[model samples]
Target: MRLFPQSLRWRLSAVIAVVSVLVAVALSLLVRTEFSRMQLADARRVQDERIQLVVRDYGLSGDATLGAELDSTSIPAELRAAVKGGKRATYLERDATGAWIWAAAETNGKVLSLKTSYADRDRALDRLDEVLTIGSAGVLVLGSLLGIVLGSRLSRRLRKAASAARKVAEGDQETRVGATIGTRPRDETTELAQAVDAMAAALRARLIAEQRVTADIAHELRTPVTGLVTAAELLPPSRPAELVRDRVGVLRRLVEDILEVARLDTAAERADPVELELGEFVRRVASMNPDAEVRVTGEQQARTDPRRLERVLTNLLINAERHGAPPVEVEVDGLTVRVRDHGPGFPDELLREGPSRFRTASSDRGGGHGLGLTIASAQARVLDADLRLANAPDGGALVTLELPDRP
Candidate 1:
């Protein structure tokens, strides 16, 4: 009763098959009806011709021998009855006196009998019907099988694309849809897979950028803040209030550095570079820490943001004093500054972390948030300088800042 199947391929095949069957059935019926009519007409013509021939033969004998010739022939008994009963085989005879007579006789006993030769035509029609039925059934079965094969291949490709997409959604950026060589997908599923890969790539880049920014911000804020807190808690009550003012000044500088780093991270503020004497700048910074001897050995003039660049150098100097053994050495090599201190070198682990926030060596003596190196690194980046930290072979931490030489 239900002719169509659920699968698309099967349903299409079924529809084609059903149509073929109906067409075959209709043609067979039409052919059978026409054949039957033609056969019946032929039988009638043959029966009429035989009856006429027999009657002519009987008349030529000049005798009214009705049942005599009928009994002597091989004509069936039923056909003989039809001839005698006058349903068929009626003959008209005319005499020389212009009188006409119609006579009917039975060659045998039955009525309306047809010869058995027509049975062959019936058998032929039955065979034709059988062939049509079998051919149509075979075609339907073959078509259905082909449809299933094609549908399964398409489904497999779709499943592969779906699996790849799910892996990407779960943060696996390396996953890719497996495509056969030179076989491009031409459907919506392929497009979806492409879009998913793009999204994963974008997310990976953004996450890395955010991490770098966070590390830079934290490292920049740590040093000055630690100094300010220490100075505040240790200031003597009997000393002139001017000493307290100096401690407050340190705190203000720390707050300014934090604000500046925040603005730089957001791209809300940009650095403005100007030409300045590099030697005078380093010498002025060294004057700030009178207790420590700061050696400057560079004479290169450079164009850079004076305030920001100065802050970068100041951070490096303070870090050296806090962590290094003694006497910080600042040497200028071409357009680069190398700050070396006689101290225990950085650990291997710190070197691998690159520019990270709150990175402190376990051997460090001071108690403060580890943001000095991170902030200095960020400032160097903003100024388009390369800052590298490594351990000197003999024994010391080496910090290098390379800037572009002014024309």
Candidate 2:
């Protein structure tokens, strides 16, 4: 469907090839023109020399039979007219005998004409043309090859830099493009690599500072939250007391979620791999939520950290149940667990950017801190699983978790 290649390497090669072809064609035309002119001039010179010889012989010996055609019609009408007017002239003509150059001039009231074969010059010109054509083709091919090599090298460097940038965006702070580029010369690609490295370093530092602040705040709130919980429990039973206790519980959970995120950010969670009957494990997790409908397509096994997977699935179920419309479904097929909710699907921003902590769904969709899916995704990563979030065709949020079946 594409008229031109999308790849930069091919685009560069094409550009160079087209330019080379144009240059070759232009040079060929110029060379051909010059060569033709030179050959014509040489032929005319030979014709003139023969004409001079015949005319001199006729003038000295009074005989025009020195291999000269007197008033010959072999000479063109224009050439004959010119000689009759006492003017010397030379002309080229081609016939069955190949090519000829004729020279004529007035000699004692007789037109003395001489002719010579121009086939040798024509053949030489043909050879020159053949050589030019071959050379032009060679230039085109060589230019294309050189363009491919240069473009490939440049594209490879750009890919490395882009990959490093992607890793950085995915929270791999240690990834650096400069390391991949090695000791290359400082060109545009090298500058881009350097820029990416600097950006990663800055982001890494800022993320560390943010994580430390979050962890410290959570740690500081833990003791006070515990005290609040105890105080709420001791209060006399009433509506206000219940509300206080509920809010205190919410606070405690928020602190826990923040701590968990901090730990995940630090990459401190290690998976304890265990072989699990994936269907049964999913059934058990889904059973905790009576509203969820669990279906197992077939028996399957996975080597993963069950605890982390449990956390991920629980979060997904809670998110769906709270935000989505009724009929939250959990389907286990192979090593994949799919959770779907007939809600307004995920918010457009959420689908575009994934989950961000504390960024809750829009008021129209549902209400909660957005940490559920974020924590779920982080835990899924710890289990080395693929967690994808998408909107179901019929309308709802669909979250798929695919676990590794092998160690």
Candidate 3:
């Protein structure tokens, strides 16, 4: 067990408990000091009155023997000087026997002294200290206990809200933190939970509206784009005709990507897995492109949706050709495909935030619409596969695809 816990719950509880104990102990000490001071003040007042009476008697009778009433050794030198000058003096001091007293007097040649032992007052203070010690300990224990319990409860609610936030970030747009947070004495944390839920709901609605717009736009463009492609095909073979055909092809691919993304957004893809030799299958796809070098380490058999998987490889290879240098390396190792190219590696943003449709890397890639890798990622999701992009250590870009043994 950790002497100091690293968890937020324990840290907060410790802070509350420490503050509670310190404040209670400080207040208790202040009360005891004031109580003792008031008791001592009362004793000194009574002693002063008796000393005045003694001095008055000496002034009227003029008796020199009245000085003998007080012990000479107990009389402090500073008090004696004050009394000799006809000024009344009072002091609280411990004598040779280590006993406390309130001494008061006035003198005009013969000292009019009065002394009272504070042994009873000292005993009272000792008893008061014992009682205060017990009371302060109880307050510290009780206050600290209450602080820890409350801290634990509050921390748990905060944790629930944090977990829900993580799920939302990971693409579960429907995630929401419960308003109640399963705690007692409704507090600020419950309000925070409600706020988190509201934010998530708003985000889900906005995303849905965005996907609907994308799907509608892609659907609307299909007929006109098809007609344009047909008109360009009928034209005589020339530079202008080729340009129109290429531009139309880019637009057609972009539209298809948008439509696919809209479908994936609505969770509409279904997997139809068929057993195949993954290594041979990867070689067959790589052979379609003459520039790429396919290296088959060993055959890895798996059950996966071939059509979706083919789309993933097609998009990835096209991206490699457009952005990366020639002699592209494709390695198939037991259900894993590592595609590396000699070029400036992927942009930092592309690695951190996964592929965004129509967002290009910092490096130039001809004039790509940037939908190739985005579509590949979406298709990989449909196949329940992992698609990762990274910058290889040896001055190149790397894309790794890993498929499960069974879909």
Q: Which has the greatest TM-score?
A: 2
Model 3 lDDT at residue 235 = 86
What's the best-to-worst order under lDDT? 2, 3, 1
Per-residue error (Å), model 3, residue 8 = 4.9
Tens-digit lDDT string for candidate 3 (317-337): 888888988778999988999
Quote the positional error of residue 319 for candidate 1 in Å: 0.4
Question: Candidate 3 deviates by what RMSD?
Answer: 4.1
In model 1, state the lDDT of residue 276: 80
Give me the candidate number with maximum lDDT: 2
lDDT of 1 by residue, 177-272 (tens): 644211465666566666656776787678658756754664665666667667776766656656775767666665565555555555334568
Output the better candidate (1/2) by lDDT.
2
Clashing pairs in 1: 80-108, 84-105, 84-106, 219-371, 220-375, 273-304
- How badly does each model clash, as a count of residue pairs? 6, 0, 0
C-alpha lDDT of candidate 2 relative to the true structure: 0.89
Compute the lDDT of residue 294 as modeled in candidate 1. Answer: 47
